[model samples]
Target: MHDLEGVDRGVNPQKTSVSALALQLEELLVSSDRRGMAQVRQLWTPGYLHTAAELFVRHCQRVVIVSGFPVGETYETDGPAGAIALLQGVKDCGGQARLVGFTPYIDRLRNCVAGLPQLNQRDLLALDRSGDVCEQLQGYMAGFAPTLLIFVAVPGQAADGCYYNPRFEDISDRTLPWEKLLELADCYSIAIADSGNHLGMGRVADPLARLSIVPAVSWTDGLVIADIANWGACGLLALASAFVRKNLLRNLHLTPLLEVLSRSGIVDSVTGMATASEDGLPAFSGEAVVTTLRNAAQTLQSGF
Candidate 1:
């Protein structure tokens, strides 16, 4: 395995050639950069998409994915899309995958995942905030024995052991102890985040903090940063689809998922409304992103 311990500090650019799928996803992320700012180049290390996807495919057979960011009164739109995409991508590879999130978002998650043939009620686990979370997760890990723990747009502990939302002002007692459990469990972990406050940003906290970006307090074996957390998740699908030479992402299904999420009261993080958009971009942006992902898979299909 690659030495990922130094990833939190920042990785020096290597001479490695990145895959076409990763490059395309990176381009997509860069395109979404705020006001032409080079946050992606500045905050994210090179070759992350390829490395993370490879690590997931190589190690995570029974994957446990966690998401759901409380951006407003309810769960935001960022986490579910990535969680579902990664779940589907993992399942498409014939691997078992499950979704985990806070208890408050259980109904939303159920509604979000409803009618999805790849997922079932058994695949969803809620982090009961009122109970002993670590103990509950420990029991869960004992039974599921996940090979890898992935955090998609999920908030992480701050240096003070508290969880903060995107505003970095709202504090909450609702925290998951996945990072603490990862230390004892025999598994690898990856964090997918757009904002630095989410899990996995701890891997790149140094560079990000040098620029005054408040990064997540918890760390992981790998970190994937993007313009939006869902994009990072879709980037993984693109990578997995390319690696396995299969179009795991379908455009027809992508639109309906967002529509369902909107109808279920999942608001866009950017617009803060229950709309068919993610992080403020319209629904067509979602279609365009998935189309690019399919194109990347097609490139691999032709042996490129």
Candidate 2:
């Protein structure tokens, strides 16, 4: 999947090519220049979406997707749908997938994706961020021995050892430090997020440092940034589906999914309200992304 050489099989001669489709995905997802991340976005240039998707399918076996960014009493809506989508996507690619996050949030995320079929409850793990681990999490994950670790919008530790919200407040207590797990990374792992504040986004910390957003101390082998974390997840799946010639997100009902999450009290990361908006954008924005992605990926009609 990394090579993109074989992805262009069909010839519409008019529709956007897979490479151009990747650029389109990037334009929508990583379009933010407000944080001075324009330079940061260029780090994985040319084909960040395609590169991340290719990296995912290549190392998707035994994948553990870590997500859930904590808000006041609940979690943000940006992460859940994306994380679940990634988990489902990984499984669709014939990989054994699992998801882990802090308690309460994990429970809520599990509830949101409950209607999705073939997902086992055991695959959803809740780590206690209260005290130190009640059990040996590292050892437990060692048992799983994930081939790829995909973190979608999980908060990252700053240089001061605290996780900060966009307002520059300390939220470290609510986060689970995944450093121990990230230590297992090789050349094959993927992280989907918007800003440098997310886990595994340290790769672009240098470019984003001038901005007010605190950069993460952790980095990943592959980073996929988006306008919002959910869009990042969608683009990742869309690109992967394009490459593999199978619609991984075709079953994902975006509207109902957000409605379910919103009803369950998952708030927007920016507004901190249990509304349909994701990171302050209208509900339809996500729908538009998925719709465009569906049309974009449809042209590449050959299997991996």
Model 1 agreement with the true structure over 1-304: per-residue lDDT tens digits: 1112322122111222336446545656545564221464555567777888888878658999988887666777777877888888888788898898877776777775565666678888887767777788788889999898898988777787777765666456555655766675678888887776787767766665654444567888877777667767877776766567676675335667778878888888777899878877777666666666565555553455
Looking at model 2, residue 294 earns an lDDT score of: 58
| lDDT winner | 2
| Candidate 1 global TM-score | 0.87
Off by over 4 Å in 2: 1-17, 32-39, 42-44, 118-120, 130-135, 185-187, 301-304
How many pairs collide in each candidate, listed in order? 1, 1
Superposition-based RMSD of candidate 2 using all C-alpha atoms, in angstroms? 5.2
Residues 259-297 of candidate 2: C-alpha lDDT, one tens digit per residue: 778887898877888888777776776776666655555
* Candidate 2 similarity to native, TM-score: 0.87
lDDT of 1 at 221: 85
Ten-residue stretch with the least lDDT total in model 2? 1-10
